[model samples]
Target: MLLHTFLAPLALASVAGPAQQDHYGWIHLFDGKTLEGWTEKGGPYDGDADWSVENGVILGREAEGARGGLLYTEQLFGDFEFECDVKINAPFDSGIFVRMLPQKRGAQFTLDDRPGGELFGIYSNGYLFHQSGGDAAWRSGEWCHTRVRCVGHPMHLMGWIDGKLVVDYQVPEGMDEAFTPEGRIGIQVHGGMNDPEDAAVRFKNLRARRLPPMAGENFTVDESGMMTLTAVGEASGWQPLFNGVNLDGWVPNGGSGPMTAEAFEAAGYRARNGVIEALHSGTAGEIRTARTNYRNFQLRMDFQLTKLANSGVYLRSVDDGTNPSFNGTEVQILDDFNWEAASGSKLAPYQFTGGLYGAVAPSKSALRPIGEWNTYLITCVGSRMNCALNGTLLWDVDTATLEPKGGPPFAERAKAGFIGMQRHGSAAESESEVGASFRNLFIRELPEMGPSAR
Candidate 1:
């Protein structure tokens, strides 16, 4: 099906798509009439009732101080897509929240696209999140299209001048490290609560939609000639998480396998076609790193899976019985389309792609399709986990579920371990073996959980 087929049922579709609308996982928020599920914060609900409509335009007047904020919505969202129209009154400021609690200093989201759209300040535990390009463009009174895509825990916020994609930002790494994946979303009318003056702003054609798992064909981009794609200060530099070849510093696990570094070359697992392809797709072994075990690092790789194939990249995995889900943790690499049919629909989020096996599940869905390559970036520390497909949030498990719940949650039992890949058995093999392949393996070590591990 087309993108429309995946996003048509979204609640507030603009009647612009197929039979319904091309809205994905979106839940209807504003009914375009009342604020039934809305609330107030920073200032009053209608800090300035002057926000009423003038014919068809939302007009904003002056309010006291700078506390003209609106913290509405009875819901909060994780990795998803949101879009709306905004018209500012000259030097206006606004905010779109995700993973927030809605208060003056409670995880505020900045949508300021104009010059100085957002100011950077340590709110929770992150630094340099609201780094605006260069405070320059801002119209006194004109409708501006706004779109925000939250993927991989970082929100890719962008502003449009009329119809042009101007401002763009990737939320500084670790910005949402403290914010929960679920919370109430709010809209701000920035001002002082005790004094509301000139804090007037109007919002019309305001709408939002949540998207679903798109094909890999929908995400590849060339950033070539895109000068704005450069990173700003304080942002984490791009780390090479994979080398695009056979597992060099990795070793295969289970049954005392003899597949060592030299063995990889003997089997023609090493290559140079821009990516490493495992020649032995019929084998039941894996290549594991002999160097280090990561706890709070990120892993990204592009892969292609077979029709009835099953596999996963195990994180902090150990050799207890060879089942990563029960041994350590597995980021499910199965096709979301057939995974349910092969195993069951009840697989926990942590057991799927970007999940912590049976411990945690991603807060959103961000997987691509077969033959085409998809990206998987998983971050783990202690029992906490976060994974993203491409740039979308697919899994964000917590510590609560990653505990030693005995048979219920096994991965939690191992604190620190090795990272490995798994090849599982299907009906064709009662031995439950894996025949999947992987290339471009890389890793980065983070500071240990405490001084004890250091």
Candidate 2:
């Protein structure tokens, strides 16, 4: 069906699609002349004054001795981006409510009061993300544009006033079931007090779009010719090591200076359909992130290999002119089915997919065959490490206890270094080109240990 077919019944669509849209296209939540998809939080008889549509804007007001209420959308959203233009009359406590449960627990972006555009949470028994600050973007009698985005996995909120980013915050973990994963968006009118004269709020041009699993996690290129890993989960904390477009964040292993577009292609890193492939490079060596020096992080990626292919993932590795296979801790990725026959012996325990190179072995093989994709989630917090492949736990050990392998003492490996991926030369007998393909390379650095972490 066309885009209009899905959105027309709700409201007159303000914007439609260009047909090839990959993300959520725009949809109008308000239909200017009526409140079709909205209902009052309390019944009409419970509120002091009624909310009504007037001159293309939704207006709410209360009398001097009246109690205020909320107008909410019947539809619920989990991760989404919402935008509207609001004009708040003075002496009114008004705000935009998002991800609110039926019991009225969620977060709010304050509109007017002490200051403007402050974020407050109703979860965790009333928490304030940040205090209201600066001048109020809303004029006494004029309209101001406001935008809000909330995402899942690690719940977060980002907001803007008059096109300027004002609030960016991440809800801390451990308050499970308190903040509802799916809830209705609400426009709140304060309950206690009201202005004797101009006690009202008007909202118009209201619209919303869906957000990703995490915020700012997509691999996108801006007009500046630079790459950006939009913040995901937390505020601007997660970044993509390989953005899957150009090699903007990587450098050829053992090579120095800023990596250029030409040098990246010459090094045999090609991106197609969101996957980075190491093809025909003939062990051209591994590629490492130019920023390097990562300490504690959770890294995730998906890999697919051909029969008899071989490669490795290196973490916290050094660049001493030696290969990352020897300088860093490698998570072995080899063709396990044919390795024993090709090498004339059974595959060693440490030579399988999730092994820690030569220092430690994976508990069992978690390979998903040669053609199917397998996911790897590797998390390193200080000296302890945990790895899982294809939904199966592979190895969880303290690197501080392993015997020394080669370069640094295994216990005293450099606290921070480069991240690399090895390209094995070729297979033993077939000599066919050996390479691997990887996608969705997401990484997030963990915060330092603190009381909250405990």
Candidate 3:
């Protein structure tokens, strides 16, 4: 089957050919003749579901004297599109599960075909959303094409059965804390229901493609070697902090107070042609969001630095003219390759890129080459902070456990404040015009649970 058909509705034509398989990012979960990439015993309740491959399909039946369980992918997926074809005998129950693990209650897309059963409904601890008329789309005893697109931080899920949309739901803000960001995908054979011993559920064409967190938008590089955004739908709550035109929502920290965007520009920062460029000037100061009190949030941005450039991302920074690196927290961003040679000083463990500035060091350096764009995903939830550089996790630490260099413990710092970006003057002695550039700055605030909740 042409898997591209599943993504046609999204207008992702750029990912349509075999030569662009990396861009397509689709992996066939099942080879149609074996269970090489699947396992049945990883989940908490590994049921005795008789699973085998026959006639280019995965066949599942209840083991003798046993009920049923799940068969899950050996690997895990975060945001992705999952597609399959299911054929279930009537009066049997089965489902497709996402973000599933032994310790986590991942959401499920119901394939229940029993009398009075609900198909395509989402279930976790309870019915997240129950399908009202899903049976109308069910093709019993036949291959029913199924697709589920799961994306975003809180997880927006959409399911289609035989090309008919049946489930469209997003995890509510209040319930977002319950669902994890990633886990294994599973196929379930529900237990405890009485049925014929020969009843079975068959699946084939099982495939999935990883998706970016931005959902309907594609970030692409143009022929001129600049990044651009292609929007296809809503960004699912991810809001652009830099509009690619100007710094309207940002203010320059002028040591005494927050200054206007004009001051930010005068301080050598300008947003032009979808990129925020910081000029290499000694007078350049930090720029922060005009909006403050960001308690729990996920911040994503792409940045590229010149040789010996130094910078940091300040989180929950106070507005009292104090250094944000002490008042809140700073994730160090530096030219990891050339900083030591340029500055004549060895970098401490906590001074490396992606480290919690002066507090916790990253496990390893994950920075891209200088002059190449690197992505940062910084998530701050209560007292815990995680930083992933260029898709590799650098650290996931509880800030309350440690103290910043020459500063108070993180537990005593401001719990909620502004998000800022620092433009530390170049480390090179020649005073070169080497500074950092940023783009695609986006943020999504999560539901705030206080420190006690952690």
In model 2, which regions exceed 4 Å deviation? 1-236, 258-262, 280-283, 404-408, 427-434, 450-454
Order the numbered candidates by TM-score, best leading.
3, 2, 1
Tens-digit per-residue lDDT, 346-395, candidate 3: 78888888889878888887785555566788888989888887667888
- The weakest ten consecutive residues by lDDT in model 1 span 1-10
Ranking by lDDT: 3, 2, 1
Summing lDDT over every window of 10 consecutive residues in candidate 3, give the lowest-scoring window.
1-10
Please give the lDDT score at residue 281 for candidate 1.
36
TM per candidate comes to 0.42, 0.48, 0.51
What are the per-model numbers of colliding residue pairs?
39, 1, 0
What lDDT tens digits, residue by residue, belong to model 2 across residues 86-108? 88777676778887665636677
10 residues in a row with least lDDT, candidate 2: 1-10
Best by TM-score: 3
Candidate 2 at 399: error in angstroms?
Answer: 1.0
For all candidates in order, the CA lDDT equals: 0.47, 0.65, 0.75
| Candidate number with greatest lDDT | 3
In Å, residue 373's CA in model 1 sits off its true spot by 2.2
